[model samples]
Target: MNTVLVTGASAGFGEAICRKLIADGYKVIGAARREDKLKSLATELGDNFLPLQFDVTQKDAVDNILATLPIGFQQIDILINNAGLALGIEPAYEADYTDWETMVQTNIIGMMHLTRTILPGMVERNFGYIINLGSIAGTYPYRGGNVYGATKAFVKQFSANLRTDLFGKKIRVTNVEPGLCGGTEFSNVRFHGDNAKANDVYKNVQYITAEDIANTISWLVNTPPHMNVNSIEIMPIAQAPAGLNVSKEM
Candidate 1:
């Protein structure tokens, strides 16, 4: 049985991935900071889903959980680094420094720590796949996406570097970059719980959904071992580059 471990599993892409994978017959461990939500998911998903509650920012917590994983959930063959957030859309000069720091701690530090802890096992077993959730913000920069974009850019590069390090091994690493996705808490959290502002961003827009991402992940894992997909950058047809920025009277 293929066992997978997903971070940020309480909601959004992580929740969707867990739900989809379980339906496809993969055993899954869903880790998140929200204990209540995780437990609720456990109740809903039954024995195949193991809800792990711990803050990814806490290295010790990650270490503890991995050390105590139950029988079916212990050997994780796939790792999805999906527990990331964008705090605000403010420009760097006017953005919250605290928000930037939090983004780094979660998007970069937390993710890196978890991957490092899981990799050795994969190496020993000679089988593993890591799919990181990146954003198009990382490649196409918007004015206010400074730190969040940079963090995802890091994910892009890091996943490539990991594949380089694991060359000649059966392990695989892929970075899944998504653009303009809605139907989740991403915008709500990014806007700091301002539903109106969040709603406005997706008003009548046909953007990607959490299920779309989960389905992509499902395809990645099922691909043949001889093949490796380095990265996939996806944006809805309704979204595209805004072209050059200009100031006629600045």
Candidate 2:
């Protein structure tokens, strides 16, 4: 069985992906800042799951934790960069600048740091796979999606560039972008714990679930090594890009 390291494994798509991968006979290192959550998940998953607690937003923490992985889990065949977030949905003019900093640090800097750390080993062994979780917002600009969308755009281009840099190597890189996903704390976090507002984002709407993402990842990992999936964009059937707003003065 291959070993995979997944960041943000405590919740949302990360948690779902861990469960799916473990069920498919892969050893998983579930890394997240919440030790309690990761520990509880490990207990349920048994020996194949390793709870790795550390904040991905901190470069030193990621460097230390990944550099000294335990004996059995030292060799990571796949890296799943699932840790990211969106802050307030307020428009750029009224939005908090702090939120933008957090998004850039976690969504861009932290991800790049961790990827750089793991990539060398993959190159040395000539085998690896990297899957980044991007968002449809990257390509479609919407109100209040300013910084969040920009970071994801970086992720998309970063994944593409990694493939270019690794040309002729066995490593594979993919960017998975989803639209209007629910069943997670994403909206709640964006709303700063306002459950009512978060809940309202999905009410009466058929949105994508965490499990759906996990399933897609599983399919990617199981695909033939000779094939490479550059990027995949998925949206709930009920969700689509909005048309340009028109201001009319009659």
TM-score of each: 0.98, 0.98
The CA lDDT of each predicted structure is 0.94, 0.95
Poorest stretch of ten by lDDT in candidate 2: 58-67
Task: Encode model 2's per-residue lDDT on 131-197: one tens digit a residue.
Answer: 9999999999988999999999999999999999999999999999999999999999999999999
Across 1-250, the per-residue lDDT of candidate 1 in tens digits comes to 8999999999999999999999999999999999999999899998999999989999997898799998777898999999999999998899999999999999999999999999999999999999999999889999899999999999999999999999999999999999999999999999999999999999989999999999999999999998999999999999998898889988
Best by lDDT: 2
Q: Score residue 73 of candidate 1 by CA lDDT.
A: 78
Candidate 1 lands at a TM-score of 0.98
Candidate 2 residue pairs in clash (backbone atoms < 3 Å)? none
Q: Which lDDT value does model 1 have at 82? A: 96
- Clash tally, candidates in order: 0, 0
